[model samples]
Target: MKSYIAAAIQMTSVPDLQKNLVQAEELIELAKGRGAELVCLPENFAFMGEEKDKIAQAEVIAQSSEKFLKTMAQRFQVTILGGGFPVPVSTGKFYNTALLIDPSGQALARYEKVHLFDVNLPDGNTYRESSTVMAGNRIPPVAPTKELGNLGLSVCYDVRFPELYRHLSQMGADVLFVPAAFTAYTGKDHWQVLIQARAIENTCYVIAPAQTGNHYGMRHTHGHATIVDPWGTILADAGDKPGVAIAEINPIRLEQVRRQMPSLQHRVF
Candidate 1:
């Protein structure tokens, strides 16, 4: 096993793709300066203007958006989770997509958001993300590396579903990611607890980068980009700002936690 540093970047992305990308690049460099080997960005880190804008900005795989991320990863010599972007699935529909790029700039894996947000919030704000974004086919999630341990891929809404995390763990995931853009209404109450629960039950490291502050004047995201260890202890947390939280992931600690609990092996269902 190996030990390495990880970082999660919180952002309050606006309507501009270029500006968002610039912010992400600067943040990635900053994380690298802090000796981070793996970096994750928040959901919708590229554009968050409107539904029409999201549709228009959607890119196909291997296109400009992915190219930019690969270039950045190679330049910084660090593995990067490209966060969530809208990828075209059809003429008017897109998939909420996440991709990981290695230090060599090769795309390692991609995870489209499986669970879509379609609910009415307590603040009278209603969203039907399924209206524009199509549901992913729900494939087995995969991330991380030989040295970093297995990483399970997830998006914002997927956090509410424990079975998905369990399935990923059964698929050999030792670490989990919940790159998100959770609404302020729900995040203030449910975010941290859900993320830590996933870590505790799976006995896996959980990295969750998030959107923060206000966007488009109509939406505000709760920003507490955090990293939790297998023992359900928070390793790092970024407050309500656009920044990176850095922490060292100790493999020894992860192993010890799993070894002591052994609950995963005791599952009957």
Candidate 2:
């Protein structure tokens, strides 16, 4: 079957690791119970805190070894994509990384946030992500999936750059994951549009899980977790709340759309 059930998990992450993990576990279980074969969590699913202060608590990938990611994938017997965790790279540098775990709880791929969220929105939501988060040099596209043919891995802010999605489409990615923790100000206006645009342009399914509601320190995120089909159709959407948006990833439909439009082939720029 070309169709697979997937879930977009939304949550308000806090600074405490245990608290966020608990929430993640609960939501993952809920999604599994609802028959989700592939579940995705929001950006900074572990901890979302202040600039440099947060980086101090970052963990090394090798030494830390994602216990929560592995446990959830194995327990649910589903593929889990844990979005944006702070991982220490060197003495001071850190990477905002996402991990993709297989049903067997094995880590399939890791994609660091190539484009950091470094913007000062008019609503006083100022962020300087590059201050502590090291930039990723590589663009990881199309991680292998048992259900979806090839899934492109991307995090928040990265969705703004169409070139990334174009590259992934060129790499034969049928589905793309864009887990984000966008601020309320920007998300309200740009989130859905960007998502649909990506899906339509690439002729691929876009699965975007987001952080909704107020988080730790009263920081609010624009939650409207959405799943868009290749035709720019919003299959499932979650408004300003913490919940799951479940949808079916149909590769055949994607192929049909690509065959009809063939935009990826018509790219001259």
Candidate 3:
């Protein structure tokens, strides 16, 4: 199969949804210009605030998300992997959603974040994503399209669980999407290692977009959006800045790696 390029967009989102969309639009254009056929965005790329605060921003997504992403993808003729958005299902509760838009401007796949970040950090920051964000029950592998290859769709906290990636790889995933807004404290130590490890073990490509820098309030993230190859090579690394990490995804290389190791086929249990 022929090789193609993908992009990972890093951002620092605030409380304003419009402003974040504008920034994302510009970055998407940049990725297109870089010849990125598939572009992924970071988690919470729309609005980042308290659980109750996101609900207020949730109602507008159903309309704006499709309209805006569809237009952008169709115009660019590139597959756009939209970042996480808040979709309200009930009063004061919403699911963190990730969408994949085809070049034809249709949402081909939508995967809600299965794992939520609910923990206390060394910096004394406590995040209870379950309080407002309802976790998704299903794990949908992004079906292969003519433009983009087979992808396993997932969100930020999901990367911590290798079992999920193993299942995805077994399900015929050629690539993996791990869009996250990793906190500064944890990311500083564990981010790159985990991302590379996933790719190496699964023998599949990994595309990870991230939120970087300090936000509207005291919130901060370690923004190192990156792409990894099947052999655990760091293909592209977007340093702690709002930018795009562009890299080529070669199916030939993926096959070569898998053939060399054959670990997936040798699994006993």
Candidate 4:
């Protein structure tokens, strides 16, 4: 794997699908212009609104999101990760899916979010993701690439689960993707810490694209789209804005950190 720049794109997506796509394209262009070869978009890049509204338009959102990723990757000549989007399932619910597309517009990997957020926060915000999103039964996949190294996939809430990233590290992942629309209440406290912990513990670079600001109604996300190195250093942070956080992903640095820490090799259980 060679060194290249990666981007974590932040956006405040609303209920409108086309508007969100336009916004995403602009960010992608910005990242590409900044010399980012691997660009990632935050969760709900296409549509963010009431759960009922999301469910009602799942098919359209799914189709549009997929098409947008492919088009962006091909046009920009960069590998693109659509952090999370709703893909319809046979049971009338959708999977919160993260998809990776190569520069040639082919899908490299896909991950359906396994963990569902079902909680009532202290701020009086309630979320029942399982009501609309069917949890993935299998573990997320790590896609091996000659130039990009092994890339692992996971969604927003999954960042709280360390074992998933452990599995990816065991599978020889060099980088982990945690695309999220993390709630503001939890994000304010847990977002950066969790991401850095994953990177440090697994000794892998982490690219986390995030949604920030108020999407609609009471749904407010903490926006800090970040790229972290293997040693848990914050490379670039797009703080609470609709923008791109660009950083270098270097194999030499990754190997150096792994050899220095040797934590992954020391795992016992």
Candidate 5:
């Protein structure tokens, strides 16, 4: 278990859930062919549609008999990180959440979006996530294989908060996964920089899978699925293209960087 290969699948999802699942299956097969042990899909990989009504309609929760997740993981024989989906909430609302499926098709962990994206940028694109989606409370990390160790799980907007990464790292995570459907305005300006900063500061590898291109309605995503090293180096990046990127994680690099900086130990604030 020296190192493992991973891939991030970018998609231009639409209103049709079945069609999107088919596309995702094709991408999973592609990733398997390319020797990816773990593959991550972009946020809303299942169904991106007209508006809140569309997402709310497609909400699914911890149901055990989900064919899309269970069958896909078994078919690929690899860890499938299904990026955020619309989940039915208690108050008849929905929550954007990520689900992790193991090779055997069993769900390992599920993490809901903590920090919903509610912003009115200068581009006149106002997003009110709270209107439809419910906020999550706990920070969940997945313990995959003994060789791979613990992985911090986060959704799109969760990337902006450094405290989240810090919490994950403190909880013994060696890698962090952030699946996003970021807008073009923010992705172009801040996506890479923010991800790298988090990785460098935490001394952990950051694997981000993103949605690229326009969806069914007017929603557009900035697609650049990237993997960054602990030293803040951009190991792999896909620029506005739907494809996969791979990187070999070196544990020695993390140890070396941590030894050099020791920033994690220098917290006086």
Candidate 6:
């Protein structure tokens, strides 16, 4: 994998699909302008609304979201990760899916979110993602790109589960993508901490795109789209705003850290 710049895009997506797409395009353009070759959009970059409203428009959302990712990737001539969108499933529910598209608009990898967010926050917000999203049965895939390193895919709440990332690392992942629309209540404390831990433990670069600001009524997200190196250092952070966190993903730095630490090589279990 050659060295390249990656961008984690932060956005305030709402119920309007077109508006969200426009916002995502603008951010992607900004990232590309900043020399980002691998651009990632946050979860729900297409649409974020009530569960009922989302399910009702699931088919439309799925089609439009996939098409948008492909179009953007081809247009920008850069690899893009559309962090989480709804894909209709056989169970009449949808899978929370993350997709990777290459510069030629060809799909490289896809992952359905395995872990669901089902929690009641102290801030008077409750999320039951399983109600609308079908949990994926299979483990996420690591797409080995000739230029981008082995890219591992996961979405949102999966950051809380270290075993999944361990599995990715075991599969030879050099970069992990943890795109999320994390709740404002839980994010202030857990978000960065969890991401850094995953990067440190796995000795992989983490490119995390995030949703920030209020989306709909009573739905606000903590926004700190970030990129961390294998050393668990924050290379770039877009703090609580709609923007891109651009950082260089260097193979030399990755190998240097791995050699210096060698923790992953000493794993006993």
In order, candidate lDDTs are 0.88, 0.85, 0.88, 0.95, 0.81, 0.96
Please identify model 5 stretches exceeding 4 Å from their true place: 59-66
* Candidate 2: clashing pairs of residues: none
Could you tell me how far off, in angstroms, the CA of residue 184 lies in candidate 6 after the best superposition? 0.6
In the order shown, the candidates' Cα RMSDs to the true structure are 1.4, 1.7, 1.2, 0.6, 2.0, 0.6
- Count backbone clashes in candidate 3: 0
Candidate 1 stretches with Cα past 4 Å from truth are 60-62
lDDT string for model 2 (17-127, tens) is 778888888988888998899999998888877755566677633234378888888988999998788888875878888899998988888998899877888988778
Winner by TM-score between candidate 5 and candidate 3: 3
Q: Write the per-residue lDDT of candidate 3 for residues 1-269, one digit (tens) a residue.
A: 36998999999888888898899999999999999999898998877766677776688864676577888899999888876888888656888899988888888889988888889987999988998888999975656765456878889889999999998898888899999999999999999999999999999999999999998566899999999999999999999999999999998899899999889988898
Evaluated against the true structure, the overall lDDT of model 4 is: 0.95
What are the clash counts of all predictions, listed in order? 0, 0, 0, 0, 0, 0
- Model 6's alpha-carbon lDDT is 0.96
Q: What's the residue-level lDDT of 23 in candidate 1?
A: 91
Query: Which digits, one per residue and each the tens of the lDDT, describe model 4 over residues 1-269?
Result: 99999999999999999999999999999999999999999989899999889999999999999999999999999999999899999998999999999999999999999999999999999999999999999899999999999999999999999999999999999999999999999999999999999999999999999999998889999999999999999999999989999999999999999889998778787
Kindly report which residue stretches of model 4 are placed more than 4 angstroms away from their true locations once superposed: none
Query: Model 5, 1-269: lDDT tens per residue?
Result: 24787888888787777787888888888878988888888888887775565544654423321567778789878888888888777786677778888889887888888899899978778888888788988776755566555777999898899999999999877889989999988898999999999999999989999888988546778999999989999998978977777777777877788899899899998
Compute each candidate's TM-score over C-alphas.
0.97, 0.95, 0.97, 0.99, 0.93, 0.99
Residue 251 C-alpha lDDT in model 6: 98
Winner of 2 and 6 under lDDT: 6
lDDT of 3 at 133: 84
